[model samples]
Target: MRLLLENKQFRIFWIAGVFSDLALITYFTVHGWLALQVSDSAFWVGATSGAGGLSLTMFSVFGGVLVDRFGRRSLVLVGLLIRFVIALALVALIMTENIALWHVLLAAFGEGLAVSFLMPAMMALTLDVAGRGKLLSATAARFAGMTVAGIIAPLAAGSIVNSAGIEWAYVMIALGFSASAGFMLILRPPNPAKRTNSSPLEDLKQGVTYVIRTPQIRMLIAMIFITEAFGWAHESMLPVMARDVLHVGATGLGYLLAAGSAGATVTTVIISNMGDIRNKSNMLVGGCIGFGFFLVLFAWSQWLLLSLAFLAGAYAAVIVYETTINTLLQTSVPDELRGRVLSFQAMMWGVTGLAGFHTGAIASAVGAPVAIAIGGGVVILNSLRIARHRSQLDPDLAQSSLDSESIDSRGDQPES
Candidate 1:
């Protein structure tokens, strides 16, 4: 917590992140609503979401390469600027009554492209500003910021859409992005990324090879993809579960989601204060298992209160798992490869988006509860399987073999 006040660079960056994240949350909320207006079909809503996810999937690696090659702060500012433009463009379309389905899709895709750059560069830059020592606390703080944004952004966007107009909602979004960029302009990293002569393709190849060959990284990436595909995918079916299974309407759905956010907030505060934990891998393992167990409980619970409690527990477990894994990965890698490595996590977001489609399909065949239970079952099984090789998840390798390997591969001096 002191890190926020003691470190000026990180303070600025964190504020910028909060604002940017708020805008992003608002965009997603507004994007769906606007999609419904332009085309009332659920299929079009899915397609609009898919457009963003597809863009993220296709361009994340290239964004990582750019992050490693250019100034990370500069990249973040650029990404924010692009998003600001996109938001204003939407405002114009909405105001002039010229908006179409294609316009919405294009804006979604553009936002995705902007995020591809924003996420990797911002991730790498976190270590740059905060240093590896405070990585976990800094990450927790960022998550806390996101949790705050998640709560506020939707409500604000919803209010604007209801009162003023959709165009005004977008106007608010544009203001948020511009405010973020303003904060970013003043941020200065402790160590700026050095320009590289390596081709983007070559850099991308090296990053892929490094993750594939490194056991710790390979295991972490695999776990993330599996969890996202099977476990997090169930999020798409929440509406169905609320209506059909729990007999809760839209208002109840909001409460259920709010419960998850509340749980995340509590966990984030605890982690932020913990400083550093030695056995992060053990925590990660436990978190994954807990996440699955809670999901199953939530699926089976007929009572809305019990389901909310279970959902909250699941979200808390995920916060633990994600914060631990992100800290481990950041501290493990050399500075040069950090962006590239973190991009893999960005890629997992894309997987979650795609997995929603499959999860929805399964829910169509079986009931939503059964489908979600199956997803949770898969998460538990995969976590157990990986738990057998605890050594690979160990952080000792981060200070020892992995550091040596990263240095040898990149020919960069180790961080002090």
Candidate 2:
């Protein structure tokens, strides 16, 4: 941890990551509520959420290919600048009463496009800075920021939206993006040793091929997609849960989300200090099962206090599962393909949005509890399959000849 802090570049990037997550969390919460208020239809809310993440489906492969071909820093700056501008634009449009569902949807599409590029670059750079030796700690530190931002952003956005209106939440979102971009300016990854002169299409093809050829990574990506699609996508139902089940207003919704994220934050801090452990595979599999059980229980609970307790447990298990997988991926993949692999990871968010669309449609027909319970069931089944293949889930690649391959898992190796 001290080594990570002593490295100036990644330290700045960590701060940048927190700021950007603040912007995104606030924007999503504010925009989701606005969509519901404007349309009064759960489907529209799902559509809007789907639209935001769906934009990534169009751009992530290209973004991933480009980041590896060129570099990370400049791409990150441009992406954040565009996001900041879009946030400011939304604030202006909303304040002027010129906003409509289409306008908001347009803004959302723009946000997704920017994020598809930004996140891959930022994560790849993080791995670059931390090197192979510190991958576990560094990845934990990065997500520690995520858990904190989750804790704070929802409650803050909820309060602002309830008091000052949604536009002010957006305004703060813009400021967060600007601050994040400013911190990014100080980051400088070590220069590449060679250039790839191949066309973008060829490079993209190579990346895809590499992922397919690697069994463990392929399995990992599959789990990431399934879990995101069914597990965490339940946020699409939160507004309805607040209105129908909990009878909590938006403020109460904020508190409920904060409770869940607070649990995740505490869990992240606790595990970040665990140093190294050998049972990561079992924990990864077991955590997903635990997340499923807790989620179903939370959905069934009609009491707010009881529901909150279950939600907290659900998020704790989720963080445990997600963090272990992500850390293992970072340590396992070679640096040359890191950007592309991470971008594919980013694509899971899009899958969640699409799955949320279906989940919402199901909820509209069957109710939130039924839809969430089905999702939990699916998460359990899919994660069980992953556990069945737990031998391939090893992060150190101890059983593979590729472990002996001359691959620089760390992008930067500046000499003393």
Per-model C-alpha lDDT, please?
0.81, 0.80
Model 1: number of backbone collisions:
0
Model 2, 1-416: lDDT tens digits are: 45445778778778988999898878767777788788887777777778877897778888888778876888888998998898888888888998899987787788878878887887777767777666666777777888789889989988998898888998899999899888877777664313488888988998899888998889888898888888877887777787778888777777778778878887778776777666578878988998888888988888999888888899889888887887777667777777788888888877777776888798888888888888888899988888877868875434442544434444345667
lDDT of 1 by residue, 68-110 (tens): 8889989988999999999999999899999999999899788
What TM-score would each prediction reach against the true structure? 0.87, 0.92
Which pairs of residues collide in candidate 1?
none
The C-alpha RMSD in Å for every predicted model, in order, reads 6.6, 6.9
- Give Cα distance to truth, residue 141, candidate 1, Å: 1.2
C-alpha-based local distance difference test score of model 1: 0.81
